[model samples]
Target: METNLADLPVRIFHVLSRELGRDNLWVKIVDFDQDPIFSMKQLEIDNFLKRDNCCDQVLRRWGNRGQTVGDLLRRLQLLSRTYENEFDSIQLQLRRKFKILRWVPDSEEQVTMAVDEETIKLECKAQGFPCPTIKWYTNDSKEPVHTGRSYTVLRCKCSTEHQYKCVATNEIPEGFSFSEHYKRPGKLWNSVLESDFVDITSLVRDDELCESCKNFEMGRLSQILADDEKVENKTIPVPSNLDSTLRAADKVALIMSNCSYVHLPELMTPHCDAQTLADALQKMNYKTVTLADLTLDEMRYFIREYKKLIGDGVYAVFYFVGHGFEVNGQCYLLGVDAPADAHQPQHSLSMDWLLSIFRDKQPALNLFLLDVCRKFIPYDAIGAFVEYSEQFKKFHRAHRNMVYGYSTSGGVGAYEVKGEINGVFMKYLKNHVSMEISVMSMLHGVLKDIENDPKQIH
Candidate 1:
């Protein structure tokens, strides 16, 4: 415990110093109670009183700089001339509580199609103080692959996207760790960043600005733009009206539902919900794609594909009907294959992350309709399971027209009515979609239908 306390200064300095752009920052832990000079009783204990009992070394850690805390402070103020405002700012950062503002990955996932031996670097960046120590590890080992500072490099073993975890820890406040899986392409740069589970893209490549990378990019650009040359890998027809034809329609619907649980009671309503909603969306002039009973990775892949399809003009509508629950204020949409034992399954997609997809795409309007509940989950501790998705949704300050519609309000369990063809939300949504009404009116109908049910209450 003492050793841990001793490491605190260095730990704080690690994260804070990097953010301060200072390489030589150090920590000195001074107990206010133990201070020989400038304590509450320090004025009474003069130089004569100090020589009577206390050691000289204990008297002045700053060593010849000053006699008291006030003198030391004045000395620091005098020395502040060299750094100007930066010294005060750095001091303020250290003197305050530890915090992480936005820890993000710098770049998209790196995929290399390299065959011959080549080196690739992956990086993680952190924005917090004291600056967090960035370390890399692989293959589930306790020993790190790389430690001290940011970024790590590895030689290519194959066309491998080697997975390395970069951890940034202050061990005082919240620490962040993220996995960076980058393939061995040509030389890249930087290290990994910090997060709860944020897999940020890699940072912009400084190494790639070299002659070889520039040449490669230019060649690729030439190949893409070459109108006079015959393209060998031509799949799509080149239209004469290039500017008019490139972009597709913005109004789209993503309908995903999971009914088949591996160990839990299978839900029949979600599958029914997805199919009916797809039909309704089609009638409403929305291009809808429905994916049902998907495993964890399959859901992620589909969302990724959906992200690629969305553009700036997209008015995207996402509908998820599935078993979902909150763990420590974070809500997760469980896939068909989510583990029964794991409280926080890696496979379970986060609803906040789902909304971030549209933020990245910068959509015109994004509406999320979640028909999620774990009412059927065979858990005896009914009181223990809490609802936090509503809170989670509120936390993200969306920059666009974003609406999060749940089947019911948070903390209340949604029930599956027996003999009903679909879930309450979907049944009414299907009914209202055919009536040629707005989505707001459709939702109002859903709420009214749910309120009228005998077995359920929101």
Candidate 2:
């Protein structure tokens, strides 16, 4: 006669007895409820005697089941009301934290802080989302008293040294703060400037004649040669030492791509895309150059040479595509041959170096396109990931005549499609330019189209 018993509990008990040993029954009983195979309340004395602590023993007793009890439990928990509530709360918090307000600088009404003989004149119009409050404080005081709306003019009567702090606070639910600091005239100069100049000159030059003496002589010569018209509008031609020459043109485009080695197969794509863009600009009667074909040294030489060639009323377009790394809130673009090793400083190029070149020249419309996202590496790599900088955004806000476009938003990777006519971005750009689309329209259209496409890797 066969005894009637549930198959799962019976088999589990048998395996448990064998694995734990019949003498060790108390151990099994104590841990039985904790075993994931059995529910907390389901482990009774009989079932406790069956199962083992070992994974193999328990798995065998479960008999090759399609879904484990643990999996079902997880699925059920996910579908439960408590889990759903927690998820909703988390999403709400995320939304609140990331909500950014539209902020426009009050450029129309200038904020002028002028230091005359004694007093300092402060003029500013307060305008921001949820309007800002202005507070003025002196270095001597810890508390800042509110200054009336119109202006705050601080007089320096007895105090030869004073520091003014202007604090602008936002009236949001959680206060946001911004402050500007200014020192009294002639105070810092005597303490900091003279020593700094002397130190810097000493460090820069070790000649027998002191730099101070040389500067005095140069100052005398400058005074003797000074004519208002001649000194104010003096022009220096680009150095002729370099082999490169910048031709005169209505418009110029400087392309710098650092991902040449990693994206070697994708070369034709950028080349065609750049040419198409050039064609569009040419139709509008502007000259262009794709700097990807030139070496880093050559590119630098050509840029310096071009400043002399194109004096004024000239437009410029600069494009960069590559892997970039950010350290201490400054972004560095990787060259084609930049080493993957973190310790090699010589391999990277600073973004500021590139920007400084154009800024020195002061082009009418300096358009920049950066396609460099963080480099991709195997997931198992041990190095810590570095964060990108706010400088990218700050650059856009600080400069008036400049426009910048990035392949992807911050902290996101920009992707290149395989088997497409070009990299996804380049392909779209080429098509738009070939159709004679305006620069602004092309950029807007591309971004919009990317939003709708499911395959967009970015």
Candidate 3:
């Protein structure tokens, strides 16, 4: 009856007293650390003096051995209830703190002004959001306009010159909206140029050359003599006996661009222009496929299949229209989800890898259309055009059959569209292509037009 719960010997005595009642039950509180005797009389008296209804009823029938068992079961049930309550509270808090919502465009939108130009357009659109207090800014400036609860026209004056973007912000945290850049340049520029020297080794005998064999022989001899003399000298080699007609049968075309993602409206115009070129090629009985429509493996497979179908007389064209970067002196075509980090080289597809695939096919004409220009990097802390012009020059040197076209000269950012067509360069190319324009003429015309435009200094 006076058993201390913390004392093991006393609790044991209480348990034994309940088990055997007064007759056989006996246990004593003993110090195991200092030897002590247990007494039966003490235990019997304790059990008789302090027996409750729950314990006494079971003890009288079952000799009181079940008292400790009833106590342990009740303690465990109380602990389980406490744990359940804590778990429920944690789950409720998580449900209240997080949510997922779809993005919505601003309400009460208006096109305040738009000036149409051949290559671009200048325009403004009024947009209103909840809790007003909106601010506006453009790519041409860092200063923003803050208008309180009033209509604001985001000013953009050059839609044809280049793509323009607008940003709106509010006082509330995480409250902001932006309009996609718009580009209205109706035409795109595609120009291809090669170094003055020719790689005569890569060409077959039937290939055409500007110099004749006799002049080439004389020029080689003059170069050897000039080197011995150490005098400034120039040698003009004669043309080769190669027929231009035979070389025409072995022509191949390669088309490629690196900017493909059309997340912004400014990209639409150029993207459509690229499509127009594809459409033109299709009309001319040439096979064309946009990279967006195929995976890397699929593109490779199609190239192989096309080579098989067209055989030796085939003209192959490859076009690319998306983001590009140069790494370790190598050009890479960035996929839609390409990351900005150069360390993640696995995300990009190498230009050489694509060219190698074509080389395996041994096509006669290799025309490569690269509409990729260095521009504002998507989601990057630093923006710079990873210059790979030297790498391209090396590739051009190695692949004699290749015709390379860049949207701008080396070390220049290519123009992009602000609206419906994704690329400004591709848009112009398509407009001419749709009119049954010849490939060579289209390249020359677009480049000339772009050079003349005062807004663009090429």
Structural similarity to truth (TM-score) of each candidate: 0.41, 0.38, 0.36
lDDT of 1 by residue, 51-104 (tens): 432223333333333353334343334444433233444333334333442353
Instruction: Evaluate all candidate structures by whole-model CA lDDT and list the values in order.
Output: 0.52, 0.43, 0.39
Tens-digit lDDT track of model 2 for 395-456: 43355666666666555566766565445566566556446655677777776765666777
Candidate 2 stretches with Cα past 4 Å from truth are 1-248, 257-268, 293-295, 306-310, 325-331, 342-345, 374-397, 431-441
Off by over 4 Å in 1: 1-248, 327-330, 374-395, 434-437, 455-458
Candidate 2's TM-score reads 0.38
| lDDT for predicted candidate 3 compared with the true structure | 0.39
The root-mean-square deviation over C-alpha atoms between each candidate and the true structure, in angstroms, is: 21.8, 29.6, 29.3
**Residue by residue across 1-458, what tens digits does model 3's lDDT show?**
22222232644434533432433221212113332221125555456446553333323332233323333323322332333222221122111111111112332332122322211222223221111122333344466533322222212112112222333332212321111111115321111111111111221221111124223423433332233221125222212663222222222222333233433112333334455666677676554433232334444554454343222444667676666644444455555445445323355566666665555444455667777654433434222324423343443436455566656654457765343344556655655654655556777776776676554533
TM-score, cand. 3 vs. native: 0.36
RMSD over all Cα atoms, model 1: 21.8
